[model samples]
Target: MSIPVNTTAQIWVPARRAADVTARGARLLRMADGCAVFAVGSGTHHFLTRGRPRG
Candidate 1:
């Protein structure tokens, strides 16, 4: 899946394929330890964080 470049917020990509961010409406971010995590939901409605395997 591809995200449009016109998106307002920043888009993140996972280092591994443990979770399908596109299927869950989520995005991946890099941590200080170089690990990857998925961020789901927007604003304060609902949010989740999950660890992903390293690439």
Candidate 2:
């Protein structure tokens, strides 16, 4: 899957991959640490933050 660009820390991920930032928003992506990041894109938030996977 292709990762989206961070516009002023704005994260826009695909639908099926949005789960990657649903909850684990910061953990998944270091840059988004401690920020008001919301799911502004499509996709199922199923696989998102299921388990804390340390990168």
Candidate 3:
């Protein structure tokens, strides 16, 4: 699936800093190699809701 442009509000931080960011409540989305992605702010909700398939 592709992330919506408008709702994409995330930050890429080094794996070491992932814990620090998460400690502040950012949701961890992905981690690969030594990089990490954390979703922040209200855009996360918008992104999730917009991508859901309606019945």
Report every candidate's CA lDDT. Answer: 0.42, 0.37, 0.49
lDDT of 1 by residue, 1-55 (tens): 3433434343344434434334355555544343345554443222333566455
lDDT of 2 by residue, 1-55 (tens): 2234543233433332335445442334423433324542333233244334333
Per residue, candidate 3 scores C-alpha lDDT tens digits across 1-55 of 2345556566665554344333244678886555567676542232121222222
**Alpha carbon lDDT at 8, candidate 2:** 27
Q: Which stretches of candidate 1 lie over 4 Å from their true place?
A: 1-23, 31-35, 42-55
- With a 3 Å backbone cut-off (N, CA, C), the pairs that clash in candidate 2 are 15-42, 15-43, 19-48
**Which candidate number would show the highest TM-score if scored against the true structure?**
3
Q: What is the lDDT of candidate 1?
A: 0.42
Model 3: residue 38 alpha-carbon error in angstroms: 0.1
Among these predictions, the greatest lDDT belongs to 3
